[model samples]
Target: MITNGMIAPVNLTANVNNLNQLQNKATPAEAAESFASFLKNALDSVAAQEQNVHKVNDQFIIGEANVNDVMIASSKAELSLALTSQVRNKVIEAYQEIMRTQL
Candidate 1:
């Protein structure tokens, strides 16, 4: 359930399914792997969204779609990419700070 207060929920079912899948894992290794998988899945989702924007833009140029659809897709893609970038930056910062620890 990621929200930025700008876009309406597009796929609640996908988020619910992801949460359900994560709940079934109990072991430490399973949890770690599930977390990694979750991040990968999120990245894949944003990539798909960016691809959708490109598709919509192309369709608009071809007279098959309109500006509104393209704008919506583009905004969604932009927000998702920004969110992904922030998460990645935070992860890297945490790793670096951990490396600086004494022991």
Candidate 2:
């Protein structure tokens, strides 16, 4: 258990070594690309979850799924999609604001 206000010291040499390995294996551009790809994947996952909820509802309509399960899945998917959209909107707003800065 971690106590409040207790900061653990990180080993700088180990961190440097890890960074060296990462730098050796990938350029800065490659790292940025990987990060962007990861973000895209996360967005895709949110959309997929929404699709799955709709699918469950469709299954229930066709008499292949339970009502309770469909409702639970749909609520979960809806909440996830809403949260993802909010985060995306915030990020876009921040980026636009940054672009508006003249320095």
Candidate 3:
């Protein structure tokens, strides 16, 4: 029963209402805290992985671990650290870009 232009008006109104509701939900401070918590968790995970690698290396040194096991653990820890550094670099770059944007 509706024309295409009429449907477009209804869709636009619904989208605007949804966007308003989403904008009202969270303050900037809350969002910043959530992001900080996420970063802390990521750092904790990386540290845990490094600790596991150290344990594997210690065991290998004492002749209590298999060579292949130590090698795999070391590689995994190296990759995790490398990936974490890359993510950090990307985040910093994004922040810099945002700062440079004209308001």
Best by TM-score: 1
Question: Which consecutive 10 residues in model 2 have the weakest lDDT in total?
Answer: 3-12
lDDT of 1 by residue, 1-103 (tens): 5553323445637756876777788787887787777777787889888878888888889998777777888988898889888988999999999999999
User: For residue 30, what is the lDDT in candidate 3?
Assistant: 64
Off by over 4 Å in 3: 1-25
* Clashes, model 2: 0
Of 1 and 2, the candidate ahead on lDDT is 1
Q: Cα lDDT for residue 83, model 2?
A: 78
Kindly give the number of clashing pairs for every candidate: 0, 0, 0
- lDDT against the true structure, per candidate, is 0.78, 0.66, 0.67
| Top lDDT prediction, candidate number | 1
In the order shown, what is each candidate's alpha-carbon RMSD?
A: 5.1, 11.4, 17.1
lDDT by residue (8-88, candidate 2, tens digit) is 222237434544555555578876765566566666666776777778778889997787767776776777778778988
Which pairs clash in the backbone of model 2?
Answer: none
Give, for candidate 1, the lowest lDDT window spanning 10 residues: 3-12
TM-score of every model? 0.78, 0.65, 0.68
Global lDDT of model 3: 0.67
